[model samples]
Target: MSEEPSARGEVLIVTGMSGAGRTTAANALEDHGWYVVDNLPPQMLRPLLELAGRVGSELPRVAAVVDVRGGDLLAELPATAQQLRDANNLRILFLDASDDALVRRFEQVRRPHPLQSAGTILDGIREERRQLQSIREGSDIVVDTTGLNIHQLASRTAELFEEEGAPRHRTTILSFGFKYGLPADADLVADMRFLPNPFWRDDLRALTGESEAVSNYVLAQEGATEFLDAYVQAVTPIIEGYQRENKSHSTIAIGCTGGKHRSVAMSLALAALLERIPGLRVRVRHRDLGRE
Candidate 1:
């Protein structure tokens, strides 16, 4: 049986750092009924879209996996994608990760980095970053896979692109530890260090923000609600502009000394407030919660 087409045919160009979970994302999209094409060359995008056009609804949501594996030909992707934009509903999704995370993943897989021909894995990664910098900046959605496992990445991908015509805007509220470094994909970042640290409380030290004790402690601090209120008001207009421009995904990072307390509590609270916005989808993730 053929799948029904969406209101308009959609094209998602999935590209990212070599070890940043593109395969996982692709699998998730496929599971959600996207017609996913893997390792497609930049020059082939037009012909692929043309084929989709001829077939109509059979391929309503098409996801093309394009990356640096195309080598120098990758230089042609931005221009090609720009040319096709006027004729199609196109969006680019970029997956990214910290250099440390990418290195760890490469080690775990026991394989050489695709771009790491002679020098160290780090060298290859830096080279790929340089080559992909322009496209990554232009991507409509950027997902950072640094702290996410394959399953989590898959779930995130589904959240961003699943059916029901997709949300007008999907926002991920990510909590992290400043010590673990910033989330590479954050579009907006807010620090919770200004608030009192729940970690300093002996009773709450062992509990995570998900625990009532820790959550209450963090939320009860002065300035907590005020920050959440103002931050929500501040981002509302920016998010609306994103919807106007057809951008569909955004990540707002909340950071504290550690991800286990203040940041986590604030993130959950922020999500609750942001949910009040019309046509917005909110998801909360504690990126560095368990690392400590």
Candidate 2:
């Protein structure tokens, strides 16, 4: 909802169809530092969450996998999820794949469908899809695993949870070059070589973009002003998209011929622009600034 960090335990309840990669998602969350419980009954959802919350100091991240195997208790999931949320901060991540994909996967693995007693595997899949529509809609994040490999899924999940360790709650990595100036890896990268060359400024020639005088001089340019405006417009959507996709870290690289003049100036500008995005962790790096 708010995407704000919660003091209560962060619980990821992973659910979906039988062949929809729920187990893979659960395992990936576990690898990403979540304490995971697989195939727990819906009846145990409340108690397990309570236990996790009490012991969460030792395990702040928790994930649980629930599926149709829970039989009648499976129907209670919506209520259980609401109760858990009322007690703590709970997030549902529904993992799903296309029915064709699921059928192919089950065939490849040679696993019988749990609901096969009623009809064909396709019928079971249709039934499962119908049953899971509500949960799917309620999920905080819906990952379509139709074409994703296990490694890609794990990497994506790690990115989503990367904010857990940040002090500012936002993590930004901005890369700059010394030639064209700094590229705002956040809002925009502005080229600053059009301004008076700080490298040729005699007294300021040896200073880097991080230097206060170079920073001040670069900011006092007409191109820099226009660049900031254009850059903000260009970079805002990328940042928003990354956040929506649950990216934990991002690197914005701005390059100049030597990473000393323009690149450096632009990097500083980008850092300042990114400060407007609340709770973002920001850092700047000059890639070739020190290279001889």
**Among all candidates shown, the one with the greatest lDDT:** 1
Model 1 weakest 10-residue run by lDDT: 1-10
User: What's the C-alpha lDDT at position 81 in model 2?
Assistant: 84
TM-score of each: 0.55, 0.54
Error of 2 at 48 (Å): 1.3
Per-residue accuracy of model 1 over 1-292 as CA lDDT, tens digit each: 4432222588999999999999989987886679999999998988788778878888899999999889888999999988878778899999999999999999998999998899899999999999999999889999999999876787688778877756667899999999999999999999999998977788988888888888788888899888888999999999988665445689999999978899998899899999988878899999998995
Superposed on all Cα atoms, model 1 deviates from the true structure by an RMSD in Å of 14.3
Candidate 2 wrongly placed segments (more than 4 Å)? 1-7, 166-292
Worst 10 residues of 2 by lDDT: 166-175
Name the top TM-score candidate.
Answer: 1
Candidate 1, position 284, lDDT:
98
Per-residue lDDT of model 2, residues 1-292, tens digit only: 4232334577778898787777767765664567899888877766776676567578787888989888777778888787667557788888888888989988999977887675788888888777888888887888888888765676566666644554222444454454444444544343445666677789787888778887788778667777767776787677766555445466766655667766677777877787677546667776677765
- Full-model lDDT for every candidate: 0.88, 0.71
